[model samples]
Target: MKLQLETIIIFVQNINRLKSFYVDLLKLNILEEIPSEWLLLQAGGCNIGLHKMGEHYPNKSEGDFKFDNNTKIVFETDQDIRSIRASLMNEKVPMKEVKTFDNYPYWLCDGEDPEGNVFQIKQRKV
Candidate 1:
């Protein structure tokens, strides 16, 4: 038996806000959405789904962003990583500087989604 990766579901506090962040800021296409419930987006070969968290979930809105998460979603891009980083920063999205190691052949940058989930964008060095 074989299983293929399809979707990554993120439990979120505000569905619309996350939807806008992925759709408008990240430029992901929506595959399916149920208003304030669940949303599925086209993220290249895989899909990203945003699920509204239950009322019992704790809301973290009063502290500095803790980069303590274990998972980071990455998006490959053909454009310049610096421009992408700058564009996201213009929208107030917390983004890190584009970096590449001495032997690395790809330029990469990391940023946070509206809900503080970490995401990275990479462009192959030409």
Candidate 2:
């Protein structure tokens, strides 16, 4: 048996806002969207699905669908890590200082979506 990871459904307060961040700021290709409901975007080999909180749980608006800090979405890029950080900085996107792990030998930086979903821009040392 084999399992393949494909889509990750993240719940957000505002679908449009997250959509714009992923589509406009991050320049991810929009796979599909149903205004105020959900939006799907191309994440290299995978797909990310963003769903509206209110649509899913009409009664839970007390930060129930906020981004989980425990999980970090990491995108491995072929581009230089510094270049990636610079591009994100040019767009005014909040990002932590890029650092390298001495043991693993990879450059990584943490960033967050408008709703605070932690994500990383990383490149393996080559």
Candidate 3:
């Protein structure tokens, strides 16, 4: 048969920060939010859910902490890559240089959210 993916839940230490990044920054629509507990955002056909990390998850001191995860979230845009990248940079979002391989049809840039979750912004090169 066929399996469908509904939501992707990421355990985070701070829900508001994630909400700010995914909703405020990336412009994803929020489906639900429970303060300091959970946040659900709509990203195209799928939903991204942020669940507050419990006490079992170790947190470093309040300064610099980056979550090391094997997965990366990718966002596709119809807008110009350079323009979008500039906008995010102006908002103080940490982003890498936009690049594309010789034969690649898409231009891509990588960046991290407030809590250090890796994400990519992509657009087709015209």
Candidate 4:
């Protein structure tokens, strides 16, 4: 048996804000867009689905919806961590202070998506 992650969905108040942050600022490609309701973004090998809460599901109460910060999307690769960090900095992306653990390096950045989701970009030590 094999298990894999196909997509990460985030519910946001404003779809355009999230789209600009993810697609324009971060340079993520847009795979698909379902009008003003949902958008599918390409992130590495996985897909990120952003759904507009109030616009898509009007029947549901907006008060019932909440943003969850307990989970995070980690971008892992063999690319040089320092170089990647530098590029993001140059682009003026707001990132948390870089930290190292057991010689493994990682950095946390404020994704600035409409839902305020946190995105972590890291490189494991070889």
> Against the true structure, whose TM-score is highest?
1
lDDT of 4 by residue, 34-110 (tens): 77777889998788878777533444323433234334465655676667667766776545555674533444333
**lDDT values for all models:** 0.75, 0.70, 0.74, 0.62
In model 4, where do residues sit more than 4 Å from their true spots? Answer: 54-126
TM-score of each: 0.49, 0.46, 0.49, 0.43
Compose the digit string of candidate 1's lDDT tens values, residues 1-126: 122344566777789988889999999998877899988899987888787776544645424443444445667777777887888899999887788877767787777899888777878899
Better structure of 3 and 4 per TM-score: 3
Candidate 4 global TM-score: 0.43
Give residue 13's error in model 2 in angstroms. Answer: 27
Error of 1 at 110 (Å): 0.6
Better of 1 and 4 by TM-score: 1
Candidate 1: misplaced stretches above 4 Å? 1-65
Clashing pairs in 3: none
**Which structure is stronger by lDDT: 2 or 3?**
3
Alpha-carbon shift of residue 25 in model 1 (angstroms):
38
True-structure RMSD for candidate 2 = 13.3
Q: What local lDDT score does residue 59 receive in model 2, on the 0 to 100 scale?
A: 45
Clashing pairs in 1: none
Q: What is candidate 3's CA lDDT for residue 10?
A: 77
